[model samples]
Target: KAAYNKYLSDKRAKSTRAYIISQGIDPKRIESAIGYGEERLLNGCDGSIKCTSAQHQLNRRSEFIIVDM
Candidate 1:
């Protein structure tokens, strides 16, 4: 699970960052592409327990968290 989680996270983060850049987000303003993997869950989904597919799907996601630099 850890390996797969990392793989997906890396893939998602890279593609997302690239897309953002291609869309004209200033490169200097961009910080870094961060892959959190399965570390942070937005909902109640865990590998140790059973969860609906929808719940698990929510865990596999990415977001751009901007902060003042």
Candidate 2:
């Protein structure tokens, strides 16, 4: 399960990066795209505990950080 989650996360990150580049953003302007996977759960829903579907959905998301240089 963990491996599958990581794989899905990786695909999501790469897809997001590709979409951004497709939008005319220079590839060089983006430093890197990474997926933390289950390692960075937003809430306490780490499989060991029961959580609502909405809570799990919250953890499945993408975040972008813009850096000013």
Best by TM-score: 2
Once model 2 is optimally superposed onto the true structure by TM-score, how far is the C-alpha of residue 15 displaced, in angstroms? Answer: 0.5
Best by lDDT: 2
State how far residue 15 of model 1 sits from its true place (Å): 0.7
The parts of candidate 2 lying over 4 Å away from their true place are none
Q: What are the candidates' C-alpha RMSDs?
A: 1.9, 1.2
Clashes of 1: 0
Local distance difference test values of all predictions, in order: 0.82, 0.87
Residue-level lDDT tens digits of model 2 in 1-69: 888888888888889999999999999988887777799998988799999999988888878778975
Candidate 1 lDDT over residue span 1-69, tens digit each: 887887888889888889888999888877887777777878767687889999988887777767974
User: Lowest summed lDDT over 10 consecutive residues: which window, candidate 2?
Assistant: 60-69
Error of 2 at 38 (Å): 0.5
Per-residue error for 60 in candidate 2, Å, reads 1.2
